[model samples]
Target: MELKGKIAVITGASSGIGALTAHLLGQRGAIPVLLARSEDKLRAAAERITGEYGLYRCDVSNSGEVEETIAKIIAKYGRIDILLNNAGFGRFADFIEMPVEEFGEMMNVNYMGVVRCTKAAVPHMLERGRGQIVNVASMAGKIGTARSAAYTASKHAVLGFTNALRQELRYSGITVSAVNPGPIETEFFKLADPSGDYIKNVGGFMMTPQYVAERIVKLIEKDKEELDLPRLAAAGIRLYGLFPRLADKLTYKMLNRK
Candidate 1:
C-alpha cells in the first residue's frame, strides 16, 4: 500500500477533503486521477498537484459516466492501485418535510455513487490482485443526527458497504478502509445550510480539510481499515452508540432548539 508512484483515483476531487487529498497524494508520489462534476474546479485541483494527475469531469451519481470514466483511467494507466470514493452530498431537513427527490439525490450521490465507482474499479483490482479502496464516510454514519435523516442513512450505508468490501477482499491482497470524519469546514456545510447557523453552532469543532487529508494518507500507507479524526468526536460517536436514546435527546435539544 505504498503511495509512492501508485495510481490513485479520487472522486469529488474538486474541493474540500477530496481536493486536499489529491494534493497530498500527489506530494506522496501517487498519480492522482481527479473526478468531479465541475471541470473548472477539477482543472484547478489537478494543476495544483505536482505529480502525474488526470482530471475527469463526471458525476458519480451517473453509473454510465462513472463506469466509462474509470474504464478510461484503467485503460490509460494500466492499473489502479487506490480508489477513493469520496464524492457525496448532504441535505438537512426534517424527514417529514424532506422531498422525495432530495432523498433520492442524497442516496444517489452518497451511497450509490460509492457503489458505482467501486463496481467499476473492483474488477480491475481483482484482475491485478492488489488495490486499496477508501470510502469517506462521516460521524453521521456512526450515529443519527438531527435534521439529517437522508444524510445519516447514506453514510450508514457507506460504513456497511466498506465493512462488507473489507471482508470480501481480505485474502485478495486488496485493502478496504472507511474514513469517518466529524464536521469539517468545507463546501458541504454551505450546501447543507447556507444561512450560516449550522456553521455558528457546529463550526467550533470543525477540522480543516488538510488535517483529514493527512490522516487519509496515513491510513493508505498503514492499510488501516478505519480512521476517525479528532479523538473527542470519535469518543462521542462511541458514547452515542452505547446510549442512543440519550444521545438523540441531547442532540435534539442542542441542534433542534435553535
Candidate 2:
C-alpha cells in the first residue's frame, strides 16, 4: 500500500508517463527501477529519482530479455515490491491497411510484454507472499476505436490478463490492477501517427503525464483493481459498451468527420 521503502519496477521509463511515474514514486520514498530500450534515457531518469533507483536497458517485447533483466533485479535488490507494466507502442491504421509486422510489434510490446514481465515477476512475488502489479492499459481496452484495431485488441488482452491474474492471486498477498488512461499527452500519439492531427483533435482535452502519474501512485496505495482517468472519457466508454450501435454512430460522426 504505502510506497515508502518499496522497490518499484517501471517499464517504459525512457519518457512520458513512465518517466513521470518513476520520479513521483521516488518522491514518495519508493526505490524505483527504470527499464526501457534507451540506455541513455534510463540513466537520465534514474539520476532524477533522488532516491535509490537503477536503470536497466530492456526491450520488453523479448521474453528472454525480460526474464534476464528481472533476474538481475532480484539478485541485486533481493525482492521487488511493485511492477508497473507501462512499456507499449501504437500504430494507427485501418486493419486492412495496417502491416502485419506493425500489429505483431504492437502485440509484442503491449500485450506479450506484459505477459513476459508478469511471468518473471509473479513467481518472485508469490514466493515472498506479497507484491503489486500494475498494467497500463487504455480506455481503448474497454471499447473499440477507429484506426486502432490492433492497439485496442492488445489493451483488451491486457485488461483480461490483469483480471485473471488478480483472481488467481486473490489468496496471495500479491495484488494485480490495471490503469486505463483515456488520452494523456504523450509520445505515443506521435509514434502512432506522424501527422499528429488525429490525436491532437481527439485528445484536445488530454491530461498531463504528471496527472496520470499521480493517479497511478494513488492506485498503488489503494490497491484498486482498475483506475480510469478523465471521468468524461471513462463515462463515454461505459456508454459505448451499453449501446454499441449508437456509440458507433456517434463515434463515426465525431472522429470520422475530418
Candidate 3:
C-alpha cells in the first residue's frame, strides 16, 4: 500500500525499529500514530517526525490500556490504514536458570501484545476494506538457540500467529506480514543479556536500525508476506532447516572456533 498520507498506528513507537519506521513513514507522507508505554520517550520520538502525528501512551501488555488507546485512536481518526506490531523485549538466559514467571512476562509482552492490539484495531480496518499489518518478529522466531528460552519461544509464537493470521485474512482486504531480522544495534541487548557475554559472543555483526527500517518500508510498499534481513543469514537458516544434521555440525564448528 502507498504510505503517502496513510493513517498508520505503530506499537512500540518509543524506540528502536518502531521509532525509525515512524520517521521514515513521516518522510513518505504518512501520519504516524505512535503508541508505547513511555509517554516522554514517545513524544520525543514523535517530534522527530517531519509532520503532525498522533501519540498515545499505551502499554500493549495491558489489555485495558491497548483497548482504551485503540478506541481513542478510532474515536478521533475514524479509520486505520496500517497497524505495525513492533512493541517487544527480550530476556536472554539459560532456560534452567531463568525463572518460570519470566516466560509469562515475555510472552505477554512479545506475543500477546500483538494479539491485543490487532484484536482492537482490525475491526476498523475491516470496515474500511483495506489495511496493512506488520509484525516485527526475530530470526530467533525462525530458529532456536542457546541462552534465549523465553525470548525465542515468544518470538516463535509471534511467527506462528502472523503466519496463521495471514491465511485467515487472505480473502479480506487487509494484509499481514512478519519482519524477522538478526541482532541489530540497539539497547535491547543490554537489557536481554546485561552480562555482555551474548552481545560479545553470539551477537556477532549487527545491522543498523535505519537499514532494517528501510527494508521494512519497502516490504510495506510491496505485497510481501515474510521478510528476513541479511540475505546470507536467511539463506543459511533455510539451508539449516533442510539439513539439520549438517547444519548442527557447521554451527558447532563456527561456535567453537577461536
Candidate 4:
C-alpha cells in the first residue's frame, strides 16, 4: 500500500520500534497516530516525526483506554488505513517461579491488547475495505526458551491471532502481518531482564530498533504476511521445528542464556 497520505495508528509509540516506525511512516507522508501510556514520551516522540502526527496517551492493556483512543482517532482522522500492534512487554522468569499476576499481565497487554485494538479499528477499515494490520510479535513466539514462558505464550497467541486474522481477511483488502524479531537494543531489556544477563548473552546477535523498523515499513509497503528478523535465527527456528529433539540437544547452552 502507498503510505503517502495514509493514516497509520501505532501503539507503543513512546519508544523503540513503534516510535521509529512512526517517524518512517511520517516521512512517507502517512499521518502517524502515535499511542502510548506516557504522554510526555509521546510528545517527545511526536516532535521527532518529520511531518504532522497525532499523539494519544493510551494504555493498551486497558480495554477501555484502547477503545476510547481508537474512537478518538476515527472521530478526528476519519479513517484508519493501517494499524500497528506494537504495545507489549516481557518478563523473563521460569514459569514455576513467575508470579501468577505477571503471567496474567503479559496475556492482558501483549495478546489481548492486540485483540482489543484490532476489534475497535477493523470496522472502520472494513468500511473503507482497505487496511493493514502489522503485529509486532517476537521470535519467542516461534520457539520456546528458558525463563520466558509467560512472554512466549503471549507472543504465541499474537502469531496465532495474526495468522487466523489474515486468512479471514484474505479477500477483504485488509492485510494482516506479523513481525518476529529475535533480540533488539532497546529499553525493553531494562524491564524484561533487569539483571541484563539475557541481553549480554545475545548482545552480538541483537538488531537495532532502526533496522527492525525499516523492515516493518517495507513489509507494509510490500504487503507481506510475516517476517523473522536476523535470517540466521529464522533458519534456527526452522531447524528446531523440524528436529525438536536434536535442536534441544544441540542448543541446550544457548537456550539457557536467559
lDDT to native, each model: 0.89, 0.89, 0.88, 0.93
Kindly state the number of residue pairs that clash in model 4. 0
> Can you write out model 4's per-residue Cα lDDT over 103-210, one digit (the tens) per residue?
999999999999999999999989899999999999999888888899999999999999999999999999999999999999999999999888889888989999
lDDT of 3: 0.88
Candidate 4 clashes between residue pairs 3 or more apart in a chain or in different chains? none
**Full-model lDDT, candidate 1:** 0.89
Error of 3 at 114 (Å): 0.6
- Model 4: residue 215 alpha-carbon error in angstroms: 0.5
C-alpha RMSD in Å of predicted model 4 compared with the true structure: 1.0
lDDT of 1 by residue, 162-187 (tens): 99989999999899999999888899
* Candidate 4 residue 188 C-alpha distance from true site, Å: 0.4
Best candidate according to TM-score: 4
TM-score of each: 0.95, 0.95, 0.95, 0.97
Of 2 and 4, the candidate ranking higher by lDDT: 4
- Which pairs clash in model 3? none
What candidate 3 gets wrong by more than 4 Å, as runs, is 202-204, 253-258
Error of 2 at 250 (Å): 3.0
- Which 10 successive residues of model 4 have the least lDDT summed? 248-257
Stronger candidate by TM-score (2 vs 4): 4
Model 2 TM-score is 0.95
